[model samples]
Target: MWIVLSLFTALCEAIKDGLCKKGLQGNNFLVIAWAWKAFSLPFLLPLSFITPVPEYLSLRFLGILALGGGLNILATILYIRAIQASDLSLTLPLLSFTPIFLLFTSPLMVGDKPEPTGFLGVFLIFLGSYILGSSKPGFWGPIKGLFSEKGPRLMLCVALIWSIAANVDKMGIRETSPFFWAFCVQAFIASGLTLLLFKQQKSISLGSRKNIFLLSLIGLFTAMGLISQMSAVNIGLVPYVIAIKRLSIVFGVIIGALVFKEKDLKLRLCGAMIMLAGVFLMTA
Candidate 1:
C-alpha cells in the first residue's frame, strides 16, 4: 500500500513538473514558486485542522520546520531555474543524487544508518548519472560535463539541500501528523515567497484564464504529491519512501519526451531506467 501511494505521489509530481514547465514559458520563477504553494493552501489548510495534532509541540520541532522551510524555498527556486535552463531529462536525473547525499545526512539528522544494500544502490545510481551525462569518449568527459552543465549543476545543489530537508521532514512528521507538518511548512514557504514575489514585481498577475488554470493545476498536483509523500513517509522508512518517490524522474523524462519533444530520448530513457533500478535496490 505504501508502495502504491509512493508511486501515485511520483505520478502527481511528474505531472506537476510538466505543468510548471509549460507555465514557465511566460511566467517568472518566483510567481510560479509562490503559486505552487499558495494554491495548495486551499486543500491542505483545511485538512491540517481536521487531522489530529501532536500532544505537544516543541521548540526543536519549530526550529526544524523553519529551517527546513527556508531551505525548501531556496531549493525550489533553484529547481525552477534548472528546468527552465535545460531539458527536463537533464535536470531531473541529477536529482537521483539526493539519496547519495542522504547517505551522509541521514546519520546526523535522524540517527539512521544505511544498510550495505543501500551503498550498492548509491553506486548504481551514480553509474546511471554517469550514463546520463556521457557524450564523449572517455569517462572524464561525462564527469566533467555533469559539473559543467548549468542545469545539472543547479540540480546537484537542489539534491544536497533536499537531503537535509528530507531528514528535517522526517523529524517534523515524527512530532506531528503528516498533514499538519506539510501544511505548516508549505505555509511558511508560501509566506516567505509571497513577500519576495511582491517585493520583486509589486503585484501578482495570473496572466490569462488559460495560464491561471495551468498554474492552479500545478499547485493541485503538487499538493496531492506532497500529501501522498508525507503519508507514505509517516508509515514507511524515509529513505525507502524517498528513493521510490524519486521515480518521478523517470516519469518526468517520459513526459518531457512526449510533451516537450525533448531530444536524446533513447539515451535518456536508458539512463532513467538504470536509475529506477537503483531506486528499487534502495528498498533492499
Candidate 2:
C-alpha cells in the first residue's frame, strides 16, 4: 500500500512540476505561486471536514508547520525565480540536491540511520538526478555553474529550505493527523500573504485561455502531489520515501524534453535511466 502511494506521489509531483514549468514560461512567478495555492485551498476543504482537527496541537508542531509553510512559499517563489533567471539545465540540478541535504540531516533530527544499502541507493539517486538535470552541450558547464556564486543561488536556497521543511513536516505529522490539515492551513495563509503582496500585479494575466486552463490543471496536480507525498511519508521511512520520490526529477527531464521541446533529449534519456537504477536501489 505504501509503495503504491509512493509511486503515485512521485508521478503526481512530476506532472505538477511539469505544469509549473509550463505556467512559468511567460508568467509572473509570484502570481503563479499565489494562484496555485489559492486554487488548491478549496480542494482541501473536503479533507479538512473529513479529518478531525488535531486536538493535541503543540506550540512545537505549530511552529514547525509555520516554518515549513514559509519555506514552501519561499521554495515556490525561488523556483520560479530560478526558472526565469536561468536555464532548466542550471535550475533543476540545484533543486535535485534537496534529497541529498535531507539524507544528511535526517540522522541529526530523526536519528534514523539508513542502512549501508540505503546509502548506496541514495548515491545512485543522486548521480542519476544530477546527470538527468544537467545539460549535454557541456555537462561540465552546469557543474561549474552550480559551484559558482552567481548561478541559481535562489534555487539552492529552495533546496536547503525544503530539506528543513521536509524534516519538520515529518515531525509535525507525527503530532497531527495524516490527513494534512496543517498543509491546508499553511496553504491558505501563504496564499493570503501572496495575494496581499502581489495585488499591484493582479491585472497581469496569462493572456491565453489555454495557458490559464493548463496552469490551473498544474496547480491541481501540485495539490495532489503534496497530499499524496504527505500520505507516503506518514506511512514509510522518511529518507527512503524521499529518495524514491526523487524519481520525479527523471520525469521532469522527460517532460522538459518531450513537452517543452528541450534540446539534448538523447543524453538526458541516458541520465534518466541511470537515475531509475538509483531509485531501484533506494527501494531495494
Candidate 3:
C-alpha cells in the first residue's frame, strides 16, 4: 500500500515538473516556487477542514514544522541557483544523493532504520539516477564538480536539506494527522516563499506566456504528490519511501522520450532498469 502511494507520488512529481517547465518559463524562480506551493494551498485547505484537527498542538510539532519548512524554502532557492549556475547534467544528478544522506539522517531524526538490503537498494537508486544524468558528463564531471563548482555544491546542500526535511516531516506527521500536517507544512512554506517572491519581484505574475490552467495543473499535481508522500512516510520506512519517490527521475526520462521527443532512450531506459531493481529490492 505504501509502495503504491510512493509510486503515485513519484508520478505526480514528474508531472508537476513537466508542467512547471512548460508554464513557468522566464519567471523569477521565487515566483515560480511560490506558485508551486501557492496553488497547492487551495487544494489542501479543504482537506484540512474535512480532516480532524489535533486537539493539542505541541511545541515539538511547531519546531519540526518550522525547521522543515525553512529548509525547503532555502533548498528551493539554492536549487534554482544551482541549476542556473551549471550544466543540467552537472548539477541535477547530485539530487540523487538525497537518499544516501537519508540513510543516516532518517535513523538519527526519525528512527527509520531499514534492513541492510534496503541500503543496497538505496545505493543502486543513487547510482541509477547518476547514470541517467551522466550522458554528457561521463560521470567524472559530476563527481569532480562537487568540489570545483558552486552549482554542484549548492545542489548537494539542497539534497542534504531534503534528506533532513523528509525526516522532519515524518516526525511532524507523528504529531498530527497527515492531512493536517501536510496543510501546515504547505502553508508555512507558502508563507515563506511568498515573502521571498514579493521581495524579489515587487509583484507576482503568472509569468510570460504561462497558461493559467497549466499552472493550476502543476499545483494540483504537487498537492497530490505531497499528500501521497506524507501518507507514505507515515506508514513506511523513510529510506524505502524516498527511494521509491526518487523514481521520479525514471518517470522524467520516459516522459522526456515520449512527450518531448527527446533522444537517448537507450541509456535512460538502462538506468531506469537499475532503479526498478532497487525498487524491487526495497518492496520485495
Candidate 4:
C-alpha cells in the first residue's frame, strides 16, 4: 500500500513537472516559479490547518527544517533555471544524478547505509540516466542524427544542490511529519526569499484570468506531489522511495509525447524502460 502511494506520488510529481514545462514556455522562469509558489499558498495554507501542525517543534527539528528549506529553495530555483535553459531530456537525466549523491550522503546525515544491491541499483540509475540524457546530432553534427554538445555546467551544480537537499529531507523526515512541516518551512522560506530577492515590478501582473487559474491549478498539483512524496518517505526507505519516485520521468515523457505532441516518443520510451529497470535494481 505504501508502495502504491509512492507510485501515485511519483505520478503527481511528473504531472506537475509537465505542467511547469508547459507553463514556462516563453515565460520568465523566475517569475513563473514565484507565481507557482504564490498560487501554492491557498492550497498549502489550508492543508496546514487541516492536517494539524505540531504546536511546538523541537530545536533539532527546527534546525533540520531550516536546512531543508534552504536546500529546497536552492534546488527549486536551480531546477527552474535549468529547465528553462536546457532541454528537458538533457536536464532531467542529469538531475537523476540526485539519487547517486544521496546514496553517499545519507549515512552522514542519518546513518543509513545502502546494501550491496542498493549500490548496484544506484549504478544502474546513473548509467540509464547517462544514456537517456545524451544528446542526438543535427544534420551538421558528426552523428547527423545522434551527436550533441553538452549544456550548461551550471545545471550540474544545481543537480548537486538538489541531491543534497533530497538527502536532507530524509534526515528531516525522521524527526517530524515530513509532509506538513517540510512543506510549510520550504514554501514559506522560498516564497519569502523570492519576494525579497526579486522586487515586484508594476509591469509584472498575474496576466490573464485563464492563465491565473491554470497556473494556480498547477501549483496545487505541485503541493500535492510534494506532500505525497514526503509522506511516502515517512513510511518507506528514503532512497528507495526517491528511486521509485524518479519514475515520474517516464510519465513526463509519455505526457509530453501524447498530450503535448513532443517528438521522439520511441526513444523516450526506451529510456524510460532503462530507467525503471535501474530503479528496480536499486531497490532490489
Q: TM-score for each prediction?
A: 0.87, 0.88, 0.96, 0.84
lDDT of 3: 0.87
Give residue 52's error in model 4 in angstroms.
5.0
lDDT of model 2, residue 230: 80
Worst 10 residues of 1 by lDDT: 134-143
Please list the residue runs of candidate 3 whose C-alpha ends up more than 4 Å from where it truly belongs after superposition. 207-210
Candidate 1: regions farther than 4 A off: 80-92, 129-142, 145-152
Sort by lDDT, top down from the best? 3, 1, 2, 4
Write the residue-wise lDDT of candidate 3 on 15-111 in tens digits. Answer: 9987777664655556667889888988888888888778888888889888989998889889889988998889989999999999999888888
lDDT of 1 at 31: 80
- Pairs that collide, model 2: none
Q: Which of candidates 2 and 4 is the stronger one according to lDDT?
A: 2
Candidate 1 lDDT (Cα, whole model)? 0.79
- Candidate 4 local distance difference test against the native: 0.67
CA-lDDT, candidates in order: 0.79, 0.71, 0.87, 0.67
Winning candidate number (lDDT):
3
- lDDT tens digits, residue span 1-284, model 4: 55676678789887877777777764567767776666666666666666655677788877877787777677666666666666655555566666777787767766667788877776666655555455353212222212342443446666677667666677676665665664666576666657645675534556778777768887788777777777777676666666677778778777877789977666556767777777677545
